[model samples]
Target chain A: MTPEELAEFRRRQKSRNWVLGGLLVFFAVLFYAITIVRMGD
Target chain B: MTTAAPITKQALPTDWRDFYALTKPRVMSLVIFTGLCGLLAAPGSINPVLGFTAILCIALGAGGAGALNQWLESDLDAGMKRTQKRPIPAGRMDPTNARDFGIALSVLSVCLMGIAIGWLAASILLVSILYYAIIYTMWLKPRTPQNIVIGGAAGAFPPMIGWVAVTGDITLMPVLLFAIIFMWTPPHFWALALFIKSDYAKVGIPMMPVVRGQASTRRQIMVYSVLLVPIAAAPWFIGGTGAIYGIISIALSLAFLALSVPVATRISEDGDAMKPEKRLFAFSILYLFALFAALVVDRVAAYQGFAL
Candidate 1:
């Protein structure tokens, strides 16, 4: 990869990683909420 | 000079937005709205947390189905102006990744729904996913002009699943909700199809306008539009919803049919814009949103001892 291509790739990778991390955290919270609701019912 | 050819078919790495695009978020919003309406309008109630989970599952399943549809129809999408900018067709993402992403979301949504809500809702969600991804996308869409008529059932499932999420079983009201959408879909989709007939023809998808000619397609749109009015009014007729929902649905359905008048009668000249079809298409979205919102409002009124 050229310098520009390499830089673009790095930017894309960083964004994808951050999004994936955010999604995982959201899912964890969701599951916890689901568990509490189920237990209460 | 010897130089290595680039191995990547994609011009750049796929962004998260590309993946989101595969979900067809605009359509997902409708699914989410209708599903929430069904949940809220049901006779009983649910915890807000559980209710949100059901809607989230419906949205995810819908997104999964949209992704799989794009993955399979990437070639067809590439041929059309409306869909050419999609992730796979635009070469922003790989088809394999899109397919796998769809499967993951599909599995996760169904499993979460079953564990979190109830198995009945989850099973319906599973069926809806399959109905869209495999039955509609893989089979009906390319094969017949009647594809939208049958495949529209896939979109109709969300509200019924939402109803079942609270009720935990099937009933006439949910079935009526499914039927209202099923009958409403042809006219709604055909209006859009009438305007974008060339896109279907270029891709050889056998849309009604391309197969039956524009006049026939318009007539069919009128027929479905007439049929939709009665079906839309049925929930009120059956005493499922109050006069509020009934009154709004009838008014909306009549307006929907009225917009079809010019579309049914007019012939398109070379330079003329298809304004009637476009207007009807725009109204169809609003009509559904308004109809479902009325249903929820009516339910609330009934719960509060005010609705007639």
Candidate 2:
């Protein structure tokens, strides 16, 4: 592959990773919130 | 431009960890959580060692059932994109080895529970395994969409087993806990099905979405979600729990209902359009964990003689 194609592949992979990372972060915060509420104060 | 070649050789994972993945760890977390609730809520005291042993046995039994489930569904797993990477399907572990491992663990766990705890607990554990491995995985999964609804009994048994381990008797409290988990399974599963409908379709499984279509599936999810709120709150209404638990129960149920109503009521031409099911799927995990945690915490308050 050319340098340009290699760079494009990396960029696409990074974007996919970012999307998954964002989802994990979102669910983690939601779980933590529920734990606090259930823990009471 | 160079095109990618399809690889013919599959590298198998030789590590023991690959075998462990056969048991669904995520589902077992809920089982352990509810089992702990059962142990905490019983009227009498249990030796801490014995109590821990019972919980361990329950986890092992649950895991064993999961392993057997994977063994039976290996072909189906291979077809589904989401599950195609499981150990058996991925060719990391042999299917027969998984079957043997599951059977061995199932017997060992049941025997240990019986000797260390009580026969009642052991019996419940055995039945739970049978219900999942034979009744649900083998019978119901390939047959109908109502599989989860009826087969959810296997998931619901942990608390009752825990209760029996401690009190050595069945009562309304444990049954109510069973009911809570039982009712929670449908919406929880259906929400997941909505997102992964293609996987189920590919494998020829009649999940709610694959068999009944999205609108009917959404309606069923809402119906279960609405039904679950009252069932979850039953402990407080019947005086099994206190004010604090009652408040949290109602609050969690309300949030769950709020999440489900939009999915059920949404109007769209595309079958896979609604994102609310995904939202509900994520929140449902939190909802069950909080509901049970509230029960556990409320019990602690009561024991300490505090008006919670």
Candidate 3:
């Protein structure tokens, strides 16, 4: 691949990884909230 | 720095969208809907967050199994026009990648379900993934005409798992829900197979219409459709559901039987159409959705202290 194309691919992959990481964090918070509620109850 | 030669582009490249498609989103939607209905229809209440987690796990588990099924059947899929464009079959993604992604998702979902909900729901989730990936995909699908009949159990587990997520115990109501979907699968799938018989025959997949001929397949579809009426009404009869659910079940089931009759009895000549099969196939999806939606409505009505 050309250098420009390789750079574009890497940029896309990085963005995708960020989205996935964000999802993971969101679910983690969800579970933590659930645990807190259960303990409080 | 000394410069090296530019690298050549690969023949095919896979993207995130290809990975997403491996999950078979359309099928996952139905699974999620049914699982949500099961969770809602259960006798007790669950934390909304926990309930969401349970449904998410069901979706992931279903998607994982779907990916694994696609991975295992890539070669077979390549031979069928309908499936030829799937990730693995299309050569856009490696089979190993699909397999590993599926296994990772399966394990992750099961573990999350155990942690967020309870082990019972998690265990059932695991069993469902195994049932679809190993039992149905690996063993049954290529072997017998009765593949869908038996393998339908895998798809039927989601609601039961969802119910257990809330109740933490197996009960007659959830089992009835399971049986409804289980019995609904054969007719639903066979209708599609009747229209696409050549696809299965070309790939040697041993689908009902391919192996038993269309006449016999249609007859069995009718038989299952007839049997489904009573089974669909069982929850209402047992007082597990309300009159609303009961009335809707009876109405939709009769409509299902009505649709099945022409498909069962009609003999197609040269240049004949597949209108009956197509209509039945489409109605079957709506039938399950409407029936399950009625269950949720009935539960909500009873909870609100309305006479149901």
Considering every candidate listed, which one attains the maximal DockQ? 1
- Flag the better candidate by DockQ, 1 or 2: 1
Candidates by DockQ, descending order? 1, 3, 2
lDDT by residue for model 1 (B133-188), tens: 99999999999999999999999999999999999999999999999899889989
RMSD of each: 2.9, 10.7, 4.5
State how far residue B96 of model 2 sits from its true place (Å): 1.0
Across B154-211, the per-residue lDDT of candidate 2 in tens digits comes to 9999988988888999988899999998999999998888888888888788898889
- In Å, residue B212's CA in model 3 sits off its true spot by 0.7
The local distance difference test score of each candidate is 0.91, 0.83, 0.90
Q: In angstroms, what RMSD does candidate 2 have relative to the true structure?
A: 10.7
Clashing pairs in 2: none
TM-score of chain B of 3: 0.96
Best by TM-score: 1
Model 3 chain B lDDT-worst window of ten = B1-10
Count clashes in each candidate, considering only residues at least 3 apart in sequence or on different chains. 0, 0, 1
Instruction: Give the candidate number with the greatest lDDT.
Output: 1
Question: Looking at candidate 2, what is the lDDT of residue B251?
Answer: 95
Clash pairs (backbone) in predicted model 3: A1-B7
